[model samples]
Target: MKKIKTNVLRLLDQQHINYETREYEYDDNHLSGEHIVHQVDLEADEIYKTLVLHDHHEYLVCCIPVMEEIDLKKLAKASGHKSVEMLHQKDLLSLTGYMRGGCSPIGMKKKFPTYFQEDILLLDRVAISAGKRGLQVILKPQDLIQYVNGQCVDVIR
Candidate 1:
């Protein structure tokens, strides 16, 4: 198979980050992270899904394990927001320049305050969207955190 290229990959390259890419089959109905984990044959917690949230005035980005859900209150506290809500699906593309199911924290149109679930710190490596569906980038969790300037906090329930 031909190697795939994506904005996320390019950004990692520019930063000289070491990473590996995984390509899998995907369709509109099968974009869920569970499906990606099945296709990639990795532990569910090893893969994370990117989410966008906001506190009306600003957007916050989160990368959490696919199987876990964000604890809004915890997220708010970690992000120093009075409260936060998921960014509407309609606004996802316009705000991040990436579609739902393919939003990666590393190469957004603009960087928001990015956070990773503290669980990620337990993993040696983690996988995240490569700025597109059907692909993922696996890298050291610390490298990813540093490259995106992301904080690891207990934001998941």
Candidate 2:
């Protein structure tokens, strides 16, 4: 079997950002939250999940702690969009260069506006997708924001 290359790590290397990748066997049936919690052995509150949304015209990426749900209205308001909805699986893959369960906050096909729930910044280090299932990278939340040029907002319900 061939190993898949993770664009997340590639981008981090290109930017000279220090990150460490941890991998395990991923079960396709597991929800992202479950995978982060069980496979990665991280608290659900400290693991952030990336969600792709489209406001009909433009795409946006929202990162929030796994235990929280996204507030579409808040996200729309923060992005200055009239409305926001979750992107379809196909659109998500096209936009982020990742599949539904594998989307990472880093290494998007194009740099779209990104926003994160402000509370995530309170963590010294958090785990996020490493561009694939069964893999995650532990890094400071601030470092991720700086690297992605993401705006911090209270976009989680």
Candidate 3:
């Protein structure tokens, strides 16, 4: 099957961002980032998962390493909201034009404010979903932060 050119990949190409795309077998058993670690043969620290959250007022994008848990309270404060809630699974496609497990921080229907764990900057490169299953995009953390205009804050535990 031909690989799909997801919006995330196209956006990076359009902006001339340096990145590497890796494809893996699509299987429900290997869907989680932890399982993906073995499939990609990369450490958990080198993979970031995209999460969409709503701070009561607006939707926000949160990226965290696969093993890390999001500290919702800190995220809310960092985003200047009283509280933040994970978007319902049913709302994922409508709110962000992304299906569950295929969201990318690079290209969304609406440019929701995005934030990442501060520790991501310490890593040289990280892998994120390429807006599609079976596709992974690897890029420098700093480059992703700049391209997405994402804030690096302490939002993960």
Candidate with the greatest lDDT versus the true structure: 1
TM-score of candidate 1 relative to the true fold: 0.96
- Which RMSD values do the candidates have, in order? 0.9, 2.0, 1.5
- The residue pairs found clashing in candidate 1 are none
Model 3 CA deviation exceeding 4 Å by range: 1-3
**Candidate 3 RMSD to the real structure:** 1.5
Give the per-residue lDDT of model 2 (tens digit) for 34-100.
6567776667877888999998888889999887899999999999999899998877776788987
Which candidate gets the maximum TM-score versus the true structure?
1
- Write model 1 residue lDDT over 1-157, tens digit each, in one string: 6788899999889989999988888789876677888888789999999999999999999999998889999999999999999999999999999998888998899989999999899998999999997889999999999998999999988
User: What's the candidate order when arranged by decreasing lDDT?
Assistant: 1, 3, 2
Worst 10 residues of 1 by lDDT: 26-35
For model 2 the local lDDT of residue 119 reads 87
- Give the per-residue lDDT of model 3 (tens digit) for 1-157: 7867888989999989898888877786666676777787678998999999996678999999988899999999999999999999899998888888788888888898999999898998999999997788999998899998999999987
Superposed Cα deviation of residue 95, candidate 3 (Å): 1.1
Q: Which stretches of candidate 2 lie over 4 Å from their true place?
A: 1-5
